[model samples]
Target: MRLSRSFLPTLKENPAEAQITSHRLMLRAGLIRQTSAGIYAWLPAGLKVLRNIANIVRAEQDAIGAQEMLMPTLQSSELWKRSGRYDAYGPEMLRIRDRHERDLLYGPTNEEMVTDLFGQVVKSYRELPQVLYHVQWKFRDEVRPRFGVMRGREFYMKDAYSFDVDYDAAVDSYRRMMLAYLRTFQRLGVKAIPMVADTGPIGGELSHEFLVLAPTGESGVFFDGAFEEQDWLSEAVDISDRESLAKFFARMTSFYAATDEKHDEAQWAKVPPERRREGRGIEVGHIFHFGRKYTESMDISVSGPDGAPLYPEMGSYGIGVSRLVAAIIEASHDEQGIIWPQSVAPFAAVIINLKNGDAQCDEICERLYAAAPEHLLYDDRGERAGVKFADADLMGHPWQVIVGPRGAKAGIVEVKNRASGERSEMPVDAVLAHIGVGA
Candidate 1:
């Protein structure tokens, strides 16, 4: 993508309303714009990052055999009524009325709707174990929506529903999702710790919220320091093997981890003094096993082997796809701007034409741009060298390749690593090679 022709409306100063670093940086970097109190319009650069994060989440979900599907943003309130939550889910639910005066709502979550769908078509135990997921927009009317997209009223989410015949089978499905979530966050360059959490309106005894530690977080969390060192990605997991799944579950749950709501002082005392860790964290993902909660309410039943009618056990998993953008920035940014991980970076490398109109610089930048990877963004805008450099840093591309008059004359370019702030002058071909795009 060429910056000169792109719709990146970067700001010269921070927006006064943005209270957090991620929110402020997102505005200054031209990633998003607030259309309302908590609703945002993602610009070109921000949309690219959003899509990248969505793809990673999709891939990880697929790895665990979860089939992807799309669900509607608006749902019939009748479905929630059937589940007895139409009235229970108050203010946060965006209630509305259609022409016929029927109650409708922009779904905050999809438990009741998915349960109704499952009850209609799935009647036999043969379809007992199925994981279905969708990436869609959701709306919740937050009384005080602030901190940019981090706590937005309208945001994108990846929600999955799992159906099983019984409690044991449902637990296995939950374990699979836990593992998938861990791997997903790891690939995105964040260490998310799974802590027992309140089910809230979802209503279940078993629930976990994955929190990423960040100084700007809203929730206080306590956990064993060992959680910081554990590598969930290295462990082998067999989703279909119940014994293996149980072992993994035991290993992870054995740790002392809980959010403030669930934290116990007695439990903290049990751990060695050096292993205790208390800090602020951002909630990025949540999962719950609500056995028969939705299925029974919605009449989602399957025939057992003994030919008895039984309600299917179910669980729901959610990841805040849009909120992750803010979370990533919150956890990784420096004074300059965001430090995006390569997996979720909008652009892998940025090509800066330091001397925009200079013939030699233009020739080198154009050549590199032609050979650059599809993920690279070429900054050929007619801006000063300092401005171009600052923009490149603010955008937080993993690498920056600067083509200036002096460097072009010597057949060299300055290659800089955004995260390390390290730079070295190399032959133009070498710079291309360093970016993994050989000339």
Candidate 2:
């Protein structure tokens, strides 16, 4: 991952078309490039960050017993027709025709397709409860797509479908998935408040949208600061027990959090003055409890204990996998560039050879870079020290290991924290220990 050899095409000036902080920084930092309006080609660094976010989402979903599977990007229009949404979905859906003149579509969402697939199997109540998920690319024909990946027409997404035998069981699954979303955002080093939200085209009565607060966010947000104090991973809530899930859901909803569209003045006044938190927010994830919306529309059913046909209650959970990259930047960046969380940073640290050709400096950087080649980016380019410093800050690795000639000669190096802007000289061994590189 040498900077000189890497395909990172960082720009000195911001792209004029970038209207948002994340969009401008993403372009100038060389994370992504626009191939067309509202579409992008993720570069090496960007793809790595994308994969890291997806991995965190996958791990959290897996922890909650969701089975992972892959679904096609293209789907038969009949799937939507059977669900009675073929004409209702509108222009955002990309309607297409194959050579055979069959009506098809690029799926904007997978509710109908998943319902049909699940119905094809599991004919009895014994297979009543199931959670299936997939991380894949999705396309939507946004009329005015902008804001980089934040509102891209083509993006990566993680969508999960849950099937249960009844309304109560579906509610439990919804609550469980909500807890998982909290854990997922926490692991990604972002505070996302779950607010009651409209289901939109997903057509669910119960819904929650997770919003990450940022000054450049599109939605006005109101919330209680108590959400910042929650440690969902440490909380003892058993998803297997119905009572426990209900209590967990109650505790989560107890916080007064909402976007301007759903804000209630009475609820806001109930919070302590000092604990009130108001800001703008960007949506990163959403979950829905639609009960039998899809199952009933598509005529999907299972056998009940009494030998009667029963429509399975269902829910869908979604995380904007690609949009999160921009959202994280929006929430965390400073004037210099993106301050990536360690969990989702493309590289854990960048090793800057202040004097690239200097024997001592080269020796130190190469040694450190060799220790974790996959996780470290070595700035071995023959660039000025100031240039290297600026680029390191722009790229926003969690840490920057500075190997200047002065320190390199003494078998020491200066370690700088990207977020705190703190630099301290430490022995070579101490540097490895601080960066979690060796041992």
Candidate 3:
């Protein structure tokens, strides 16, 4: 992870095609590169961030008892046809034909495929409640894919499917996902408000879109200001207790929040003017309670207690795993560059050898690098101190430990907080302690 040997291709000037802060910073910071209109190749630094985000999503999903299992990027078009969506999905679906002329597609979503799988194996109500998720690449042919990964045609997503025997059970599954999404965003250092949203092609009457407030966000959202103050993490989550889950559900639904598609002027006007907040927001996650939509269409049925054949109620939850990289930048960057949250930061800290070839600086940086975690990126490049500092800021590591000639000679180093712009000169051992690395 030495910067001198790393593949970070930071740019000095903003790329002209980047219309948003996240897009510009992503390019300038060398996190990603556009391979096509909306497809990107994640470089080393970008891939680290992507993995970090995926890990967070995985942890939160696991907390709610959702099992992780990857689905394929390419799916047979027959699956979509079985669900009656092959024709309905239209242009966004990347339709293709194999050499033998069999229809195929890069799956935009996995509802139909998951349903088909569920129907084959899960027949009894004993397996009534199940949540399976995957972090995988998805393709959607956006007519105008712009804003970097924020609206990319090819992107990574964490999509989960929940199957339950009936509507009531499905609602519970939706609540679990809602809580998991809140916890996921909270751990990522972002406040995402759950707003009622249109189900769109997913075709669900009950749906919630988790939106993170950002000036450059595409969706206009309105909500009660109280949502900003609510701490979803502090509330106890008892998924096994139905009453407790219902209580949590009640608390979340009490808030008045809606995206443009679900906005009601009369309901919004009812809020006191001071409590009303209208702002642009990025949709980071969505959950749907689509009772029997995919299951019935795809013949996914389970045996009821009364021995009747019944289609399982279903829900799908999605998090924009790749888009979150851009969303985080949009919500947290300053003029210098991205200020990554520690949880999702590619590197917790960057060690900058301000005087690269200087013996003392090199010694100090090398020592710190040896002790730091594998994720730490040591900037051992022979670049100017200013350039190194600027690049460190642009790359958005949560902290920067500068081993300058002066500090190195003094047996000290300067630890700079990327977000606060605060620098503290301390003994090398203290620097190690500050960064949670043993000397």
Sort by lDDT, best first: what order?
A: 2, 1, 3
User: 229-320 in candidate 3: lDDT tens per residue?
Assistant: 88776878798887888899999888799999999999998889999999999999999998998888887788989889888889999999
Q: State the lDDT at 84 in candidate 3.
A: 94
* lDDT (0 to 1) per candidate: 0.90, 0.92, 0.90
List, residue by residue over 129-245, the lDDT tens digit for candidate 1.
989899999999999999999999999999999999889999999999999999999989888899998899999989999999998888889999987787766778888899999
After superposition, candidate 2 runs with Cα above 4 Å error? 272-274
Off by over 4 Å in 1: 437-439
Residue-wise C-alpha lDDT for candidate 2, range 272-312, written one tens digit per residue: 99999998989999999998898888999999999999999
> Clashing residue pairs, candidate 1?
none
Candidate 1 residue-pair clash tally: 0
